[model samples]
Target chain A: MFTRNPAGLAALLTFVLSAAMVFAQAPNLGKPVSPAEIAAWDINVLPDGSGLPPGSGTPADGARIYTAKCSACHGPEGKGGPSARLVGGEPVKNMSSEKTIAGFWPYSTTLFDYIRRAMPWQQPRSLTNEEVYALTAYILSQNQLIGERDAMNAQTLPKVRMPNRDGFIVRFPDRTP
Target chain B: MNKTPSDRIKRELTDLQAVAGNGLLHRRALLRGGAALAGAMTGYTLLPSALGQQLTDDAWSRVPGSTVPDYGSRSRFEKDVVRTLSNPKGEPRTQHARTPHHLINGTFTPNGLHFVISHAGDPDIEPDKHRLVIHGLVKQPLVFTLDTLARYPMVSRMAFVECGGNSAPLFSPQPIQASVQALHGLVSCSEWTGVPLSTLLDEAGIDPKAKWLIAEGGDSPHLSRSVPLSKAMDDAMIALYQNGERIMPGNGYPMRLLLPGWEGNMNTKWVRRIQLTEGPGMTFYESRTYAAILPGGKAYQFYFMQEVKSFITHPSPGLAMKGPGFYEISGIAYSGYGRIAKVMVSADGGKSWAQAALQEPVHSKAFTRFRAPWRWDGGPAVLQSRAWDEAGYAQPTRTQLVAARGETAQVPPVTAFPSQHYNAIVSWSVERGGEVKHVYA
Candidate 1:
């Protein structure tokens, strides 16, 4: 066939070469992320405890960890310190005021997620899962939201109700006076 | 002082000649001014050297300057600094830097002067290693690199991003004496260019049951927010460029989630991952920090759309009136829902109002400049502006907002009312001596 039509053979060869070049240039725009890679970065915990890692911690253990790691910035008892206050302040009444994890935070899971992802002010994402759970328990117990001896695991953390859980009302598209 | 345009130009030229004769224009000064003029001519000028140098010497000299061009830095002379509010003893990473709105003019905010509200500080990432993974509840989970995403079809848009607590300080009983930018600088408008998120989501083939997509950043906090899929498919974009240039490091270099008209925090910067889900992730920012307490002791959550709001930039706190005679009252009005219909200017407090002229091409979810002609008799007066959107939503007064949202005691002193969205009418009191100040009417 090539011998019969030399021009056609030349055009065919050019087309094939260009196609090969295009494929070769961009071998893979980006490699497919493996499930293991996703798991390493997918550390988000939902309100229903979807991303909670396997860990257990008591409020007593949390108190000790809080003193060692968090107290420098978040105050001695997580009340009115250089960093954001974690424990004190009243719940949402008729008047708007400062928000605390126990009084304002709707999900207990958020405490764990926030502390695990960003805490200690200077060093972030450095706490172990057990340390995060213990810190959450200590902050909650200090606010009188959880029992002092209650061990916060994946199951109990989600079950722990927050004061402002039902306080939030969806008023997005229709926010009239 | 009542000179026409041509007369003003001639007078300015005479003044320049007089200054030159007085030998005030030194060779170094002339060189600097000439460079500034050349920069202005080429449209590469960041700020006028006269203003930039003064401001730099005053406060910003201590901060570092950008050496690399790709990273993008501001002019040293630019006086519009981000007023940072943070604990002096704690790490400065977790702080809010307010944009100087009063110092800026027109609709589009300069990238360098844009406000920043950092929850866990800015992160440094390598673009070559940066990857955006789209998984969860999809037929084909895909991972895209910066170059790959850039290869897709691109779209450009102009929108605004406002922090949920932009005007929380206005809730104070006594009017806060601050520049408009210092008080409301958390909000900023920019022209963003990138590929539509819907195009990527379509390629991934989203599942019918997926309701929310969690957008996570690569920063230390890994800042994440659950954005509704409807919005994602409607107008959301993974922005790669800002104001016709590559995104800056401070403003989410490489990639950012540009959610038009949504709360600023929802537009995650340095975006790295997006996971489709059936419900909101209920992250710390969404469930707690951004929520506002209402009158009935209930908190308002997911209050995404910024309501109608407007404020007079000229004759504001910083820019005093020079023996007010004939002046054009200028300001900006914007709405998240739709285009601005009208802006009403009130010089006699709330007793009477006059409709101000809206600038042409009032784009939706963007800043619309407005101006009204006024002849002041050099008397004490109160200036205010009220905005109305195409949706018939009128900007509320401070009293009305307080009545609707309720107010707390002045315990924190910084913010008396913690309502995340406070789009109320802002008032500026003018004294007989041509001094202007913020006031609550």
Candidate 2:
């Protein structure tokens, strides 16, 4: 089996052997994550409306649904709670007052995405997209932003400026405003 | 004499004391005693011989039903100690959560209630697919699978991983009236067992030119930061096991890098990539944020070492003292530098000091529990606890940290922007009604 030049074949053999060793030894080298996966899970929506999901809801529809599914915890008038009160948009001069969805939170999208993922703790993710829309609408209506008869959809959801939109600043390690 | 199980539990403490040769032998004794107390077959002189036998029998076995673990947790009794959901309605996958410290015991936080601050949400990453890559300035860039890591001999240590930004809320002018655990519980201790990173670096052959190694997590947005290579080679561990078993899902499951005594963020979770680079990873986390300026205009950079600190876990705010008859003042004391040697509690502010009895087996970088017998006179008393570590570092008050750093002087101007890292002597004003509220007398 002698050949004029077996050096190329020997080199080829070495390369193949080395490649096999690398894979066999380290089987789980991670691949660069894909963009699609990032989008699917990055559900955090900023107040300036950066991560708002595509869809919409009206205050009128939100009200009817709010009374049915949400009012149980948030209270019928959205002011008291078996659950959290949805009213009270701003902290008052009185530090002892109860701060609710309006006064305590800094963003409105937090409400939409929050309800979309974690509402009805006993039965999370039980609401439909339209129902979440309607519920959001009712909350906005209760907040005095939209009318009870108005419909809200994704296009309008981000545009529904929250009264406390300017209230939030990113809390980080050090540096205060 | 061959003593019964309970007697053994007691002897374990003595043995532990003998082993430590230091006052910290209480635990070695208790654990050994507890084991023997359960296993001893012989009877003892004290109590009924049947009681000794019963102790042995109890040690020999738990009820068949109680031993069966289909779905498991630390214990139902320890269930009151749990993590607070930061977002009542955000994705549990990425949302930040924390442990409830008001109800815990001793210094070690159960793996379940350890605090979490995740990025890009929590990835349901499979253990089989976990990988750790070591590249950058090295003789050879290498990728390590979990099995390959397991093949190496492991070292177990009761170490702590604390967030550099832990106790962020303490900067507020007002007392954050939550449990001490909720506020500072971002720090937790576990007996982490894994391969020392130095061994891997030795295998891969770290370059003399390489100054920093950037660690990146497998979570989306994959939190990353640059750490000094010197620190990595010193005490850094690629921890695969936490508290004896595989790492918890919330903690870097499969494997995470435990940079002892350093900030928690540097201990990346779901740790897949380790690029050996001289520069920072440039991830939005470590770059744009985490760097804060100090008073003299110099910035506190890299990972920060948490100073000596201790918090009274029991009898915290929102906790009722039950009219203060004979109450046990118990809590955890720990330091990033080394073991905590002393803990002193003051019932009437820091006017008087009484040494707390430290539990045995006081390990390095782990929580050391201390307890003291207290009799509340049902009057106005401000309760506080102070811890001193072996390094001679004492827990500082808020005034010291603020005056030293001069941080945020311009931020709030007059409102007195709460100083971050305000390791002040927290006081709790105990009322006659068993009500406890955070106070700064």
Model number with the top lDDT: 1
Give TM-score, chain B, model 2: 0.80
Which candidate has the highest TM-score of all? 1
Candidate 1: CAPRI quality band: acceptable
lDDT of 2 by residue, B378-409 (tens): 67667778888888888876667656544331
Q: Specify the highest-DockQ model's number.
A: 1
lDDT (tens digit, per residue) of candidate 1 on A1-177: 899999999999999999987743422344456667788777788889998999999999999999998888788878856677888787767545567776678889988888887776678778888999998889888988888999999999999988878888887656574
- List model 2 lDDT by residue over A1-177, tens digit each: 226669977887899999987744532232333335334333434334544566667776676777777676667888867555686545422212233455544445556666665565545557776777777777877877777677766567667665544433233222221
C-alpha RMSD values across all candidates:
10.9, 12.9
Provide candidate 1's TM-score on chain A.
0.78
The runs of at least 3 residues in candidate 2 whose Cα sits more than 4 Å from the true structure, single-residue gaps closed, are: A1-177, B1-67, B74-80, B91-94, B279-283, B295-298, B405-420
The Cα error of candidate 2 at residue B67, in Å, is 8.7
